[model samples]
Target: MPPINVIRNALVAGSAERRPAVLWALASLALSMLLSSLGTSIANVGLPTLAQAFSASFQEVQWVVLAYLLAITTLIVGVGRIGDIIGRRRLLLAGIVLFSVASLLCGVASTLGQLIAARAAQGCGAAIMIALSMALVGEAVPQARTGSAMGLLGTMSAIGTALGPSLGGVLIAGFGWRAIFLVNVPLGLLTFLLARRHLPVDRRGPQTERAGFDTLGMLLLALTLAAYALAMTMARSHFGPLNIALLLAAAIGAGLFVRVEVRATAPLIDLAIFRDPGLRAGLAMSALVATVIMTTLVVGPFYLARALGLDAPFVGLAMSAGPLAAALSGVPAGRSVDRFGAPRMTIVGLIGVAAGSCMLSVLPTRLGISGYLAPMIVITASYALFQTANNSAVMTATRPAQRGVNSGMLGLARNLGLITGASVLGAVFALAAATPDIATAPPEAIARGMRITFAVAALLAAIALTIAVASRAVATRPVRDEFSVGK
Candidate 1:
């Protein structure tokens, strides 16, 4: 609401002399994480209503969600690198404003096309927020507290995701589909104010681009990510000719991207960063774990309703157990990581997840909803631990100067994992079910599909566990307690 200089000067003059602003700063970061995740999830509930209102098919209305995802996927990493070159504070503030303004446009748009375009803009803002929020944690909290800070942000993210569907349903039912987007306006403004008031000022220096980096790498990476994302999402559960062509293009683009990055003066992503064993393991495990988690979301509903004979409301309630568990476990998970160390905690989390997946695979349907719910709770809570540890390890491993791009890389990994799970794992479910139309599949088929899917999920978790254990052995230099915390 106030000019940047006025607020900056006021906070600078008073803060530390009067009161510590650490709590407020963390709160602002937490809110930014929340808003970014909410932007991701809250739109799905509107598709049916949007289709009816616009007289469009489900496929047509789907773009409202797809555009937002594609925008984030393509631009997230590039924006993060840009933030490093410029100033994170400036970029984050701009992102909050853009996201807020886009929400307003989304609410007021008269046509679906306009709404989709606005959603894309909002996704760009979200990309910036998600990337920079994690990057700025070092400035907001002490090294000793990084784990807890990461945990809090993780909790907020889970809460945002868990809250979106239920909140969207209420807003749409009471006001209209428009209300869902409109609600973000006030929250975004508050986040902006808190951020402007509390976040540490971006260090004043003559900033220089790493090596006068041109835009080619970013463009190439975006197109490559875009092609892969489209391949995964454009035809859900169907790997048709188009999907194959897109996949080929993505592969070629990836090869070209690597070649370009290797030659660039200031590469968007430093290829050398991946040489760190712990950091590489963290990113790879994050993707693998995300894929496992997404499989639950995709397959859980059908298993609950069809296999367990639950009603619609019961199904919704049951399906929520995973997110709720994730939200509840986040803070504790972070604390554990901080106390026992991220590498150790990461292994523990993977084991828990693997155990839960095994339970899901073998537990008989005769045991009913309890069997399904129990395994989900275990998986979610364990995932919370893994996410916090992996994130903290990865962030701490990177130098401060490169944190933004590295953080963006973490997000990109998770996004790709989600996309992969939705397509590849979804196909696995369909095949295991042995049904052309999953919607009409009998209860036995649904149950069978769920079991088979989770068996595969457990195997994936085992693979992640293998990677984590193996990474520790390969670590030439263990991650220094996040830059020697408390030293």
Candidate 2:
């Protein structure tokens, strides 16, 4: 009913000091992003310790990470849509509380099963937090500054990721593997308090009351994602009848979800968002960025440890380079996106990733640790540039009311890329190596696998580059400020 700038001013009028409100909101959301990102990578360093502690096989112990990934990927969309309906702040605070409790449960678990379940619960809370954090940050800042806000969040995530392996290693060595999970409790509580004190409360309106929540659509979508995750995780080794059944179930569930969403008054995921070419391109690039990042994360340790004969500590150090690079470059990349627009930035970022991947593919088998460093830094810094710009682009293309689901879509693209990267790249590595057990494989085999995997990753990045280039002419529509707090 009012001009967009008036609506924007009204939203920030809750606090006399708009600058302070923006800072606090950014800080709180950054913390949420950091914690969730930490959870994604921290447990990885402790996998062997966990396996030994539980007297379980590596495959069984992997459930600790797999469970978290599955839960987060499956539930992020539904929970994000729920955040729009109830309140982003309320959902985020609750997520922090739940994450803390789940962390406690994980710390005290006596059996591997209990720990897996706790990790799943932790992932559920993480899904809530991760899905809303970006949306909230977008809502808090003016549209013009959205890129910078997203950059801050992206920077925190890089820091968290960089810290995860190093921190997890210290915790495992000092206390135990359980200490890794236990550490989240205090951090979660702190985040909860800060979010409660700083985050803006959602003001209910006619839109909130009128939007129908699609419960059945949510269920079908969850089932689809869960089945897909399971199928992907098992595809490498368990391509049996059971895996086939899971794949079929996933297909069926996806079909049902599509059918339900088309008819629902308020779909769990609004398919209409894909109509915007910029949003679609951004989502695709987001998936490609995730794939590149996750593939590097998944494969780098093995290459460093096995091919170069680096120890665990050295491997951790080597892996930290990319995140460090990402952290350093994130803010500048965001600011650049704000000034120059996202398309050119995204294209440059993807080209950098492809170039880095190409370098990795041709790297010599017997090399110094320094050999890995340069390529990783390039890849990660490029990812930082691409991510911040793409995120800003996606947010700019949609209305304020759609932020929740659009954020969810972004998260979905990321998780799907993660799942696909880990599974598909790992499978490619294994197949290239001609052995299922890559850890124990010969140095030559490991090197070969790494080269092939990196080559494939480069190709994926190249494809994403093409998409980004093609979408350069598409204009970003202004975000509708229809749901401001005071309006």
Candidate 3:
């Protein structure tokens, strides 16, 4: 027997022995979440600087971020499936190592293409880190405590987001953009070491029961997401054969992926999960919430910098408000979800988001930092409320054996929303202002574009609110002892 298996058996047989392992595993996972979340937000703050440094057009430079997102979105489900077959602990450790190396490469890249490639590699690692983090938390913590555990994890994510921009600003201003990536190296190394030492061994499914990897499904899914992202991102570019080709490919890929998933013995994503209305509604709302959050992330900075004439530090400070609000609200929201159930909280939270969006859409153009702060706080606080409750709802509805893939699906929805939000909201801004690049567009044009984008986001929030209103409530289920080894 493997050493990890021995450890797992010993820990499972002794309740006192399990506590330290659980704490260590949870702590490691929380740190991993924080590190990965920090990387997600930090890159956004450097977009303008990167464009300037590379002398690349905004459309060209946007690929730096888009490439990362696309890679994660395309591969996360497949990676999550792999985690169940092998072990999440092993995969997570490998992911940390890969992320660290990719960060080093990104910091040293001399060209835009090299940076973009490195960022994609980083995203690949990020997919593993993200897909398994929540699943691992679920496996390690008791069912009764799962809500609070998830809340703490959510708070860590919010803290990372809260710190990212301000940290990015200080790093970029003092040390240059490379510091943002280089800094990850040391942190990644630490996380990798801790994860290797502390993360629990996987011993869930029998080896004979695990199916072969769905290679074809993964390929089709990748093509579908990549082509769709390209089509959306390049919609503002002059019409061309290449653009039309991408759209056609996306359409074909989507049709084929669905067909393959429906027929496969073990699909990359199990389509059957959607049959549960509560899970379905939770996922739908998750995507929309992420869309609203990312739209602000992608669009708000430009508006603040251009229309309000703030510098990187000031812009970073203003942007920090949202995540700070999210961090502050995450725990309370999670407790609320535990006590009151997810459905009611989701409805209330969605309303808050819609109201915040409306406020942002109508705010005056020249109110300085204070004006942006209030709307941002409101939007993000609502996001915290929605996300904590909605996530609890989704997890409660899913079976223990399906946690890895389900968590992957949840992440997939988020990244997909992010991809769509960045592309659609960006396109809206561009078309509204009649410009290809908001970075260089006139302040009035940016202001007009921002308003339109926020209004659209508000509409999206309303749609999610409607879905939550009609969805079934999630019932709290007892944790199965067979699946509760760590707990």
Q: Which candidate number has the best lDDT?
A: 1
Give the residue spans of candidate 1 off by over 4 A.
Answer: 1-19, 204-213, 476-487
How do the residues 230-253 of candidate 1 rate in per-residue lDDT, one tens digit apiece?
999976846799999999999999
Assess the local accuracy of residue 440 in candidate 3 as a C-alpha lDDT between 0 and 100: 93
In the range 122-166, model 2's lDDT, one tens digit per residue, is: 999999988999889766777777777777778888888888888
The global Cα lDDT (0 to 1) of model 1 is: 0.86
Off by over 4 Å in 3: 1-20, 46-62, 108-113, 172-177, 236-241, 306-312, 363-371, 433-448, 473-487
Alpha-carbon error at 75 in model 2, in Å?
0.6
Q: Rank the candidates by TM-score, best first.
A: 1, 2, 3
**Model 3 RMSD in angstroms:** 7.0
Please, what are the lDDT tens digits per residue for candidate 3 over residues 1-487?
3212322322232268676777667667777778878878788779999999999988788888877778888888778878877777788888889989999999999999999999999999988888888878767776655655666678778888777777887899999999999999998988887788877677757755477888999899888888977776676555478878998999999999999999998787788877888878877888888888888988888888898888977877777788888887776777776667777788888999999998888874656566677888889988888887787777766776677777888888987787678777777877887777777999899889888889999999999998887774233222354358656
Query: Who wins the TM-score comparison?
Result: 1
TM-score, structure 3 vs. true: 0.85
Order the candidate numbers by lDDT, best to worst.
Answer: 1, 2, 3
Q: List the global CA lDDT of all models.
A: 0.86, 0.83, 0.80
- Candidate 3 residue-wise lDDT at 392: 73
